[model samples]
Target: MRKLIFALAPVIAMGGITLAVAQNATTATREVYVKARPTDVLSSNLIGLNVHNNAKENVGEIKDLIVSSSGQLSGFIVSVGGFLGIGERYVVVAPSALKVTYSENDKKWSATMDTTKDALKAAPEFKYEGRWSK
Candidate 1:
């Protein structure tokens, strides 16, 4: 029994030290507390927002957001060429191609693309293959 205890002494001490370190990590105060935005913009809120062209014309509404497996933004699906949601096509666009800005007077975030409505409508449409989601 004494021989067994001696052999386990170093292992027991190492485990205790590891537990203490883990406890210290959890109890330590956070040094960084930065906020993402002054106003909390929910992902749900952005889903159906109006999408506009650079010409200030109401082109379409945001259909969906495409994200990669790594959680990076892949693109946006803008519903174009639709009259009240009819005859509309969902087009995928590069995220960097659009400009998103907050309007202080309106108290809302607006999205704008440099391309025209007709141009976006002519682009390739987005279709789900049942394997991936928007």
Candidate 2:
């Protein structure tokens, strides 16, 4: 009984130490916000951005980013052209398609797409007077 009590004492002490340590641990909650500088933000580097069409071709590059009145990025204004920027038409792309990535080899930013250029051009152009969401 004495030997058993000695062994159990150390085990009980260890359990107490563990409980004390656990009680002493502190927990914190933090909030983080990620914002990009207007100058640092570029239309060319957005990821998963694409111009898609029912015919499956990418038409052109995104010309500008549109934001909400509350300052959140809403969509992309894409410019599609066949003979350079001269004949381009503008379209809006959903923000879901855009992602951001870094490239070590090129040492520059690039945008990737799940859709082709031809497909993008095939999509309907945004009418100047109408909301893109429509």
Candidate 3:
């Protein structure tokens, strides 16, 4: 009886360990935060974003990202048109249209529509009106 009990003890311990590991694996994933500088964060992965207007014309490139006081990504400030920044227009794009992706080869972000520069320029600029769009 003693020998049999000793043999069973190891098996029982292994079973309990397996059960604990399985339970942990099923738990929901948690978000992790990493420390980064403000200037570095904005400059990273934002410089080459291709900007298109409502008419689907490629307007320009992303100049910088604007963050709100609450530490949330507000919008993208893009430089459009003009030679040597003479006639360039800085437009703020909503975050909804932006898409960030990473593939085997190229890693970049883009807007999902063939929006034209003129249309983007004409779209209702972001405002702080109390009512939200329906």
Q: For residues 75-126, what per-residue lDDT tens digits would candidate 1 score against the true structure?
A: 7778888677678888988777766666789877787877888888789988
Q: Give Cα-based local distance difference scores for all models.
A: 0.60, 0.47, 0.47
In the range 1-134, model 3's lDDT, one tens digit per residue, is 11111111111111011101111111234212224432222346556667655465677677666554433456666666667868666667765554433343654444434566666667555432365221
- Judged by whole-model lDDT over C-alpha atoms, candidate 3 comes out at 0.47
TM-score of 2: 0.49
Q: Candidate 2 lDDT, tens digit per residue, 13-124?
A: 1101110101111123221222443334343454324444434455456666665543445566777665655677776776666333445797754444465565566877
What C-alpha lDDT, on a 0 to 100 scale, does residue 9 get in candidate 3? Answer: 12
Better of 1 and 3 by lDDT: 1
Candidate whose TM-score is highest: 1
Candidate 1 segments whose C-alpha is farther than 4 A from its true place: 1-36, 132-134
Which runs of model 2 end up more than 4 angstroms from their true locations?
1-59, 127-134
| Every model's TM-score | 0.66, 0.49, 0.50
Lowest lDDT 10-residue stretch of candidate 2: 12-21
